[model samples]
Target chain A: MSTNAAKNLFIYGSLLCFVVLVILTIDTMGKLDKRAPEITEEVNAGKKVWHKYDCIGCHTIFGNGSYFAPDMTKATERKPKEYLKKFLLDPRVIKADSAMPKLGLNEQEADDLIAFLDWTSKVDTNDWPPKPILASAIAGKAASAGQALFQKHDCSACHQIQGIGGAAGPDLTQVGARRPDIDWHIRHLKDPSSVVRDSAMPAFTDMNDEELKALAEFLITLK
Target chain B: MKYQSHQIALNFYTTSVLLFLVQVLVGIIAALQFIWPDFFILNFNTIRTLHINSLVVWLLMGMMGATYYVVTEESETELWSVPLGHLQFWATVIAVGAVVVGYIVMGLNPQANTEVFGTRLLNEGREYIEAPRWADILIVISVLLFLLNSFMTVMKTRKFTAVQGVLLGGLTFLALMYLPGMFYTKSMVKDQFWWWWVVHLWVEGSWELIAAALLAFMLHKLLGTDVKVLAKWMYIEVGLVLFTGILGLGHHYYWIGTPEYWLWVGGIFSSLEPIPLLLMVWDAFRTTRETRVPVQNRIGLYLTVAHAIFNFVGAGLWGVIHTLPQVNKWTHGTQITTAHGHLAFYGAYVLLIVAMIYVTVPSIRGDKEFNQSRGFQSFWWMTISMVFIVITITGAGMVQTYMERLLGLDYVTVKATYNLWFWIFRAIFGAGFLVGVLMLAADIFSIGKRPAS
Candidate 1:
């Protein structure tokens, strides 16, 4: 191309792209309220708390930030709110092996952070932090309701089943054969220390009787 | 070196190399923290913040220095204000020094709101450009001073070579792009949205223009190539880079609460991001072969060539692997992104600045022919080690994706168990790179020394 032609292409082309970007940005901004509508006062305060602590320094949200820790984009969806709160306050209490240094947040800060995370979880991220495809494949069949509960509670973060979970908790691949009793599993779920002395597992105090039964029944099939 | 004011570039280059050394050292510490979490006095996050912030500052400083030298030579005029250049350099140095110290002190306490001089201490907690609001302001002032000095110098000559115009334009855009990242947004969505305007746009958008300008200037200086052809290629390169990169910002937007339309837009545009880089690489090689003069600064030539090849691979190819939503769905926020980042930054910007220093510094020191042994050795050592590091880190990232993202295992578990070897290899190769950096420093400092005569 001639020099003038190239120069014009350079100038006009960039301008065209910039205009398209601005228009798209406007359209995106218009749609953001509907897509991420949960931006409340608590969520805004929680965002400041996020920046104040430099949480993004380690944990990523929306795939931005250092990747030293887990992405928080789906944190609210991954763990229960109460569990996340306690973990934020003191990570070692929940996972003894967590590398996260406690940020020493007050209850209000913890609450706000969780609110921000909950809001992030609800944003339309084009299905990012994608569902673990192999998780279902490794389960060897369609996910059962109880199996879904196992994942819903993020139990795999602590417990292992079929060699696809964490090592912090015991391997549950043969827990059905070992325990062999649904009622025992139910009792243990409700109060871990009650069943086993000094169990590191936190009690499923938040799980209802149906959830507890469903989870315990799933464990019975793990053998 | 021909102009009286060209000497100011020496200070900038010296400070930049020192910051480069700081980046590598802090980078090693950050790498160590990956395996031994308690290895450092500071947390990994703080160490990482320093490592990245230092990289950005050093490269910007180097670019400023290079621009000063290039502008004066191209315009056939002395710098407009040498004292102002010195002032800008010192201001930058102070701001960077204060920011680094603030990060360390805050790392000790881990408090975001620790006030110093009536403002918050340390970073704004965002990655990359983590400078506190005050430091950010100081940086803007320093950059403005630099722009004014360059602008005045160019205006004195009343001549606009492609090199001068493009270089100044790139510097101006570099300053402008940073404004979006300065303010805090109440919404995380908005904050991240604007943050890319600085991070993504600077690297992919504005910095590409700077790189093209520098490449053209260096090739012309080294090879006596025709400026008309160089300018034409640069124009083509800049046109395509902006055409693709501006919209390619959509790739970052896809998973940041932006509309789903970005999945299509980001993927398509970013996939095309490599085309211009590839063209530039081809053009560089062809130009090297068609040179009107034999190259004297062989080390500079080597670095410049490496810059184009690595830019294509590290920034273009690696970026495309996950730019598509189909692939990015799993790799987003993983170590795969980390692999891409380290390589892309080193390949695209770091090598360019290092090349400029190699080419210009010897001239500044009045050396007709300097010792090339250390320069050649450092070039090989740094490049080979960096390639190996990128390979190992990509291995780690792939494993993390498979085990953690695919198999639903925990991230920490994958890192501790499966990816430990990768991080170990990364550190080992990082040490090799440190050796290269030291050698380069030694070579640059001793450029004027007679070699065992």
Candidate 2:
């Protein structure tokens, strides 16, 4: 092609692309405006709080921050509203080992932040930050016995069950599905260092066979 | 070396290399943080902000320096104001330095105490363009001064090559695109939308023009190729890039609260983004084949060729891989994105800038060549390390996608599963990349030992 012709094509093509982008952007703006939750003054204030604190520095909203923390796109749905409020006020209070430092937000600021999160949770993310499915079947009496044992042992201190506990250890909400081998669980709990060499979990050597079996059974039902 | 004002470029290049080293060091810290979260008391966010901002600043400095060298040489005149160029360079360096220091200081302080100061002194926490408002203003001023210096030189000479014109035009657009990033929008969607305008447009849009012009100028000089033919190819490449890249902004809009039509627009347009890159590769090879002159500066040729080929794979192929909405849904905001980012930046911008440095610095300093073995070793070390880095990260991303997105595993669980890949990425690839950078630095700085060609 002639140089002039190529230059002309470049200009024309660029114009065309620009026109299409403008149209698409306008269309997207309309759709997003419609899909977006009505931003009340409170929500707007909450958004300011989110930015003022630079929540995005750690937590991702709509999949856009450092991956050190959880994706808060669906934080509202993932946990109880009260749980979120309390956690926001003091993360360490909820989970003593949470990596999230207390941002020292006031009551209003905390509430506004929650409101902002609530608004973001309503955005159409194409069903992202997928919800974890809990096991539906109820555990038999042994599993109940395990739950009692879990509470008695204060397992929530180091491990998260469902979304409420320390983040120091892995969440055991899906431990049953992840590790189907009950034998591995029993061995891990008893010695804590047998399966994983660098495991920080303290051994529950004091628990008798019955308690260990019950705890393993209860964990197996977490799927 | 040829022009008296070319010394200005040396200052920029020196600072560019220094900043590049700092960027890599911070990048290593950021990468290591992913494997061992408690490795340092410093926040990963702060390290990451430093890494990305330094990359952008250093690359821009390199581009500015390269443009000055090329325009001065092509116009056959001294710079309009060498002192102004120095002023702009120092302004940029100080602004960038201040921002980095602010991040470190704020990161150490309590968030509550620094919240207000953060808006002015500390960063805004936006990715890529995270500079505070004051720093952003300083950058805009520096860019204007830079544009004025180049524009005045071109105007005074009244001798404009097609290569120079394309580069100047690209730089002009680069400054204009950056304006959108300064505006604060309340809507997250709109904020993100404009953010890509700066990020995507700069990388895939204007920067490609700059890269092509540099490549064409270098090729014409090195191979004695017809400037007419090289200019025509450059024109075509620029056209193709702008046509696709403008709409290619859609690819980032997906799932960011934008409408669904972006899926179609972004997917279709961005898939074509690589066409211009592929043409660049073909142009480089074909021009070399058609050259009557034997290639002198083999390392320069090697870097140019490597830039073209790697750009095709990194920016073109990997970019298209996830451009599709179906694919992006799974890969968005994952290590897959990181994999593409590392390769694309390294392949296109980083390599192109380095290639320019290699070709221009020798002539500027009156050196014939650096040690060829050192050049080749650094080239392979960097190249091989980059390839493995991309591969390892891509593997980790795909696994995370399957386990977390597909199987609904927890994010932390999926991340923990990829500890091995992260380790490889840090210990081997990261170290190799740093070593390669040091070797390149040594090769470039080793002066007066070799005889002039």
Candidate 3:
């Protein structure tokens, strides 16, 4: 259902994305006020997580080599974004036997990962999920709070979290239970920035400590 | 005096306020989780359910209460039937009760606990949708009667003030939005789409109508502020929020996998929606700056002004930071989004309710100067606490987002990265909110007068 993280050329390309939007409205740019750019935030969060953990030390992406972990030449295909985001939260979540460190990704930054990893998994690589030899990366169910999230975030009317809901996202039917807590959920949830560079999961830390803890607990429970 | 809906109004108000206290508890717990992933009641599914369900229930209760109060005044008649009102109230309780049962008891059952709570929820919460559907039914039925009751009263003897007009409009939309929320489908996208018509539209859309109505009535009565001026401001506020707020719907679309167009639409529109609220802050301050006329809810007014300003900065300014399609493309559903939701909700929704309490509590007591000293002092403390929470949360979220996204780190690492700040900030904010709540409780309970006849 997913692909390995592909070394995207977009890191550099994403900067251009901002440039294009600004250039199009360059004339009224001054007239237009500055607001936060959340779409980019998800990706940036992911990128930051990637950097903070020194992922490059253990993994190679876009062909800059590494022998420690699998090459991310096609990581997007390897796991779903949920898998990636969760993995970043706790590497051991995905592979309890993994030697990789749990990089301590907070719950809010983790949500940014779904879109970023979704993008990464969709990279136009020749082969997908990178390791056909490896079992398919399971889909992480929508966080148990997924539906509540839909409601709390008002995601239901536009995007369904579970069945009996909206139509924006695919039903998170086994996203949690099925999806492995490997590189997919953990890495993506952490920043989503490294892979896609521009994502939509805004920083969820705006929620109070209680909300974040509860939401994270709920989302993680999806499996 | 024809409308005996005073009881209905009082009942709804009572229920909503209590629910708000519940919401506060849930909110506090949720925030604590972010700071300490393995803290008390760390079960994600249960906690998330508590946070979200309580928020919806409390907000709905408040709207229902406000609606009953305003409609009776507008129509000058008893709600069509007291029996019907009783039914709706009970139905709402049952429905919310069902939802709670599912979330805390069933949804978060230990078998469902996976690694981190968020993921396990994704996995296990899905299987439990059927249970909550019963609650949904009660909500629909109760709301239907509510809408009909409000409309019936209005149609019979509609005396519209700018205040009442806003109330009428809000009640109408509340009815319209519910129809779409009833669909059953496998598509998360479609599900989310329809739900927002209920949730988002309520806050940004219809609920605002209610807010405006409540505010208008409260203000006019308190200060004899000209309804005409208030109406004009309300009109502008609604215009800006609608034009841009509808686009604000796009903010929910980013990670849902609907289409890229939403990214642009949601990103641009929602980002801009906060502008009106920002302007509202300026307008309120501009209007009130020179006024020496103090009212019962002067503290409430302070809270209202604070809400608008924070809504501008927290929800508007901060929301725009990553609300763009490109940014949403990257930042969606992350801790970054959480930060945005926190400040935005607190500034926009919570503050309004706080202001409402300040206003209504005093009015009931017939005191022009309600707890003047304590109320004013409490208002300052609450605002300061709000600022502190928003700043720390935003800062922590940004750090997490950057660390995870840019660097490709894991979740645990990000948590560890900002570990100290998260704990300290959350604890501080939590303590402040608790204090404010205590003061407010005292203010309301004391009532500042002898027992009513």
Candidate 4:
């Protein structure tokens, strides 16, 4: 009886040791990243650069950033390329304290990043806060020039994104998902919603059709 | 001090001590499994079953013992069937032993050609313990005997006092309500359906009735409060319990395939269930505040406070948090549910029963003030223990919930994360509760012939 008991105990202990070894080996062997490295690397690298420039410190995206600067969340929602290229060169025309010191850029990297942002805002994020806006913001291919026009008109003074703030305006993170189309936005930019009874965005009828389209297209996709 | 009947009080101490000991062992094993997942020859899943099932058993045993004390005295009769009580006492012991043994079989069964995560190994937990549905049937039978014995006593007397009625009703509910368990097919929806009928109904429904009358009886008997006033409160308390109680089962139905209507029902009504329990506690303090009764068995007094603390922890906070279907959506089947289960079971039901024992056991000696200070000191001890239990269990559950649900961490990883903390928490609480039980035992049995002083 004693020998049998001892034999049983040894068998159980050995079995336990053996099982642990197998599980550990299987776990290590199956370790895999599963996502394509190149695309992931590019996106992750852009996120790091975006974080470092502290672009978010001055300009808001997805409703976070400093209040004094224009919200760049709608940068991809542009209608004209000329509006973006012209404004990137002249920062002060947008605001007096436009604390947005002109960060000089060659058009190539600028276009890539704007394209990246455009791609990001169009992903189907369901109803969660970050994903949908990021998906659409990345998709608004021509919205950059219009983004520049809104800043030129000093819309940054009233609005905020990601967390940067303007005291007087509405958040435009998912506004592409929230509001009506370009005609309404342009006419609203031309008149206050009170006079218009439909637009809180002061009307920008004063701007030429190209600038109006830039701003209108940007606001339209927000919802 | 008002006189308490001693025969009733003695029964309480014997049961409370046994329960505390069971908890200590269960806590130790639960810790061991965490310390090493394959701690035993088998798996953590089987280990988890033993831990939870033992907890349910010991707690039920303790509560039944406490009810025995309250009912026997309140009816103004010697226990109507002491023999049946003893029979029940042995049946419970065997049932508990059977469950523990069954789990071991459940664990070791996984040993046959087992590899981790193998479905074959996993099936062993259910298969080896293919306890003929007879095991649960046995438990129900034991409860039926207890119910029959208790109810028959009420019929023979042809009188039901507030305390006897509540205690009788509780025992009957414990027995009859389990009828749902028989119809419980293995589907998650059906199982959860009837499981909550027994679980929810016993804890929140009939159990509340017992707590009120027991509290009223003990206070009126010990502190000299008017029974009539307490009885009126008991009436209101039972109404409020049932009014909120039946609907309170809606909380369980929330996550199950039951219609979304249960969300509206459970979310609203079950949240309201704690009000009466809280009101009863307030009434205890307020009614007793005006009268000062010199006391015997201060251990019993301390047990009363332990009772109130655990009642709040187990049935109150735990009940309220998981009452909503949305919260239950994530917390259910996770450690969050376990945390609430432990604190609520031990703190509320288990502690109240212990307190009832503390009050009644010393009555037979006809001494109002024998060993008063020690009992009160133990009361603080038990209260502090319950606080540790509720806090730690809640923390452990929350960690598990976040890991498994929010973080999407798999089961093994989630269990490993808070495994150490559960052991540590159970150790401290288990030790403290055991100490309180020991102190209570001395008061009930009386350590040394009362010093002739």
State what share of the real interface contacts each candidate retains.
0.77, 0.38, 0.00, 0.00
Report the TM-score of the second chain of model 4 against its true counterpart.
0.82
Tens-digit lDDT track for model 1 on B1-453? 477676788788888888899999999998888888778778888889988998999999999999999989898888898889888888888888888888887788766466455335676788887788898899999999999999999999888898888889988989999999887677789889999989999999999999999999988888888999999999999999999999999899878988888989999999999999998899889999987676778988888888988888999999999999888988888899999998899899989998999889888777568777788899888989999999998999999989888888877778888899998999999999999999878876777555423
lDDT of 1 by residue, A1-223 (tens): 8988998999899999999998998898788878886678999878877877888878899988988887888777746576677778887766666777776788999999999999998988877777787776755343677887887777876678776776656779999999999999999988887887646566778889898888888999988
| Candidate no. 1 TM-score | 0.94
Which candidate comes out best when scored by lDDT? 1
**Candidate 4 residue lDDT tens string, A24-88:** 32442232122112234444333323432334333434322222133344454432233344344
lDDT of each: 0.86, 0.79, 0.54, 0.55
The superposed Cα distance between candidate 1 and the true structure at residue B255, in angstroms, equals 1.3
Return whichever of 1 and 3 wins on DockQ.
1
Candidate 3 on A22-70: residue-level lDDT in tens? 3433432232222112235565445433433334433434322222244
lDDT of 3 by residue, B1-453 (tens): 234565566566667667766766766775665555445543433555566557667767767766776677556777777788877888788777755664554333433323232122212232112223345556667888888887777777766555666676667766676666654433323434455556666667666556555655655554666666666676666556566665466566444334445556676667677677776777667556645676545566777677667767776787788777665544543455556666777777667666666665554445445445666666666667767776776676677556544444333444544445765786678668766666655555654354323
Ranking by lDDT: 1, 2, 4, 3
Count of steric clashes across candidates, in order: 0, 2, 235, 67
Total backbone clashes of candidate 4, pairs 3 or more residues apart or in separate chains: 67
**TM-score of model 4 (CA atoms):** 0.59
lDDT of 4 by residue, B75-110 (tens): 555456777777777777776676567546534542
lDDT of 2 at B139: 89
TM of each candidate vs. truth: 0.94, 0.86, 0.64, 0.59
Q: How large is the C-alpha RMSD of every model relative to the true structure? A: 2.8, 6.9, 18.1, 21.3
Candidate 2 residue lDDT tens string, B1-453 = 677778888788878888888888887877777776556777676677778888998899999999999889888899999889878888888888888887787667635224453353476767788777887889889999999999899998889789888999899989998998887766776777788888988998989889888989889877888988998999999998898889888888778787777778888989899999999999999998888777768888889989999988999998998889887887777778778888999999889888888788878878565556777888888899889888888888888777666655556655654445664465568888899889877865763347634
TM-score of model 3 vs. true structure: 0.64
TM-score of chain A of each: 0.76, 0.61, 0.36, 0.34
Per-residue error (Å), model 2, residue B294: 1.9
